[model samples]
Target: MGKAAKKGIFLTTSRFSHEAEDYVKGLDAKIILIDGERLAELMVEYNVGVDPVATYEIKKIDSDYFL
Candidate 1:
């Protein structure tokens, strides 16, 4: 046998990418870009049951604004 395909939380808006197709097809997470706080909420809403990997790339708000 061969190695199984790695599974991950695929996020995408475009229906073209394989990730997007998987997400839209309910095979993966449909990641819609949003604020950290908002993203957390959505994760909960979707019952992901895990902490999102926070990155500056997604939350571009200035540190000052976070306060």
Candidate 2:
């Protein structure tokens, strides 16, 4: 995949160095850099490698319904 690939995703548990970040800016394709913190956030957000422990919903008295 040469010119056909216009976008890419790079995931790392650590981080991207300043030089590595700067290099992608000059490239023809778009590159997304995901660091450790963000990777964890995305994993939780998308339910990847995770399990739902508990969920709760709050309810209030409906005066209109009572009336």
lDDT values for all models: 0.52, 0.92
Clashing pairs in 2: none
lDDT of 1: 0.52
Q: Which digits, one per residue and each the tens of the lDDT, describe model 1 over residues 1-67? A: 0344334343333224555455546734333434456666777779677765674655566999779
lDDT of candidate 2?
0.92
Alpha carbon deviation, residue 54, candidate 2 (Å): 2.8
> TM-score of each candidate?
0.24, 0.69
Model 2 agreement with the true structure over 1-67: per-residue lDDT tens digits: 3668889999999999999899988888989999999999999999999999999999999999978
| Model 2 misplaced regions, further than 4 Å | 1-4, 58-67
Total backbone clashes of candidate 2, pairs 3 or more residues apart or in separate chains: 0
